[model samples]
Target: MDLRQLQYLVAVAEEGSVRRAARRLYMAQPPLSQALLRLERDLGVELFTRTSRGVILTDAGRELVGRARDILHQVEDARSAVQATAPDDSATLRIGAVAGPLSAGELTRPILEAFRALHPDVTVRLRDTSFADQVDLVASGVIDVALVRCPVVHDDVDVIPIAAEPRALFVRSTHELASEQTLSVDDVIEYPMLGLDAPEWFSSFWQLDPERGHSLVDTQLPPVSTVQGIQLALAAAPLVVTGCATMARFAPSPLIRAIELPDASPSIIGVAYRRGDTRPVVRSFLEAAASAAAENIALLPNATSSV
Candidate 1:
């Protein structure tokens, strides 16, 4: 009935014990138990099956858990929306993006600059994170807005396509394949492949097989940083990397070249946030990203850029 009851119920369901849940919720066991009882009474259903092994969700409990999580998420969103309206004194916007900026052929400065202009007091903290996990992070109030690659399959979060840039395969200029107009999966398999630090939608397209002659020369390198991946590929044989035109423009190495694979489609880069969050600052940042994305796409390396 009350938010506390729902909160207590969720804690118990997660912790699987009234006593443990109480510890996690920082409350006494008896009161937590009473809250659950009251909730079950109001709902007119048994939510959990109690045992020494800990609580097991009854069919009803399982059903309620999903709704409870949604409810909690909505509550958190509402609270955040309120706080975000009046810019905080901290003036910090915590944003996370898929780590490969140079390889992805995208630039984030336009958005960062626009946001800084409006909220000069607001410092943006950008972290290299996974596109896969970012949706949940935004929905759970972990990050304000996540720069993610499409297509997202979640109903709880909303994604706005900010840019669509071609995916490129980077190789050293001296490599045999580097001179070719385009390359294929088989053509580059024999060489050591440098992969991104995090998985994007395009990762599945490569489909490298270890048993089928494509051996991983190194796995110990940090797979998340684009800079690191490029560095590793430069040192190794036949490094297969992906990026866009924007990346090639800013690349530090003259030896590195971006080549387009006719089969490799352009990846969709987007801004993602909680579906229901209506904060003005968040909205302003989204607009800025959209605007910057439109201009930056033109700068990204196209499939036709001289490799």
Candidate 2:
């Protein structure tokens, strides 16, 4: 009935449990439960069906949840637009980027230069982040935008394709696959891979398979989830997987070589900003990125989302 109730509805729908949603919202369980009850009563519809594991959205709930997100995004846009009636002359855009391509200056440099050329007065700041954390950073407002690899999931962000980066399978030089000049997805999926402790969509993007990813937690394969996991990966690297053809620039030891995945589609490197964020500076940055991309990588646009 109100924005508060809609927010409560979305939180519960997304989390699939009242208790989990309450914890995420930093609120107590009782009030949240009452709010859900009140919302259901007002709508005269059962939004959720409770079960032993958690709450599941009913048909009505499923229909309303998407509209609720759109409404929230529009409300945010109105608020941002009102607040920006008088633009701040000294605005700083904080950009987050994955370490590999960013370090190699393959994905971000031209866009950054183009942005600077267009918005000479604005200040730009950079932070090194991984594709794993890029979306969360933008969604949580930790940064203004992110340079990330595509085949990524962005249910709550807008990703604009800027360039294409080739895909390669990374293996330790001594690994058996290293001798192969070209490989296919079928060739690599059988082996252990460095499980990126990332969203399922992101972790699975490299494989080009909706059902497969390096997320088997019990496997002996080292992960890229933490600093210790990274260390373990360096010591005994597994099949390092695809999409990050420039990873060797940041990683050391055990020696790695990238074998061409001649059949795999190249990943589209893009700039992702929170969806419905239509601020002028954000627009400027996007336009700059598009222009730079057109002149540089000239990649075709293919939009996607996990949800």
The TM-score leader among the candidates is 2
Cα lDDT tens digits, model 2, 157-266, are: 66776556556777677887878888877777666566666665566565343324233332566347432354456347545566444454445445666677766655
| Collision pairs in model 1 | 103-243, 105-244, 197-223, 197-224, 245-300, 245-301, 246-300, 246-301
**Candidate 1 displacement at residue 206 in angstroms:** 5.7
Give candidate 2 regions above 4 Å deviation.
1-90, 103-107, 207-218, 225-235, 248-254, 298-307
Q: Using lDDT, give the best candidate's number.
A: 2
| Candidate 1 residue lDDT tens string, 11-41 | 8888888878754443345546777888889
Q: Per-model C-alpha lDDT, please?
A: 0.63, 0.67
| TM-score against native, each model | 0.54, 0.66
> Candidate 1, which segments miss by more than 4 Å at Cα?
1-90, 100-107, 128-142, 149-157, 184-202, 205-225, 295-297, 301-307
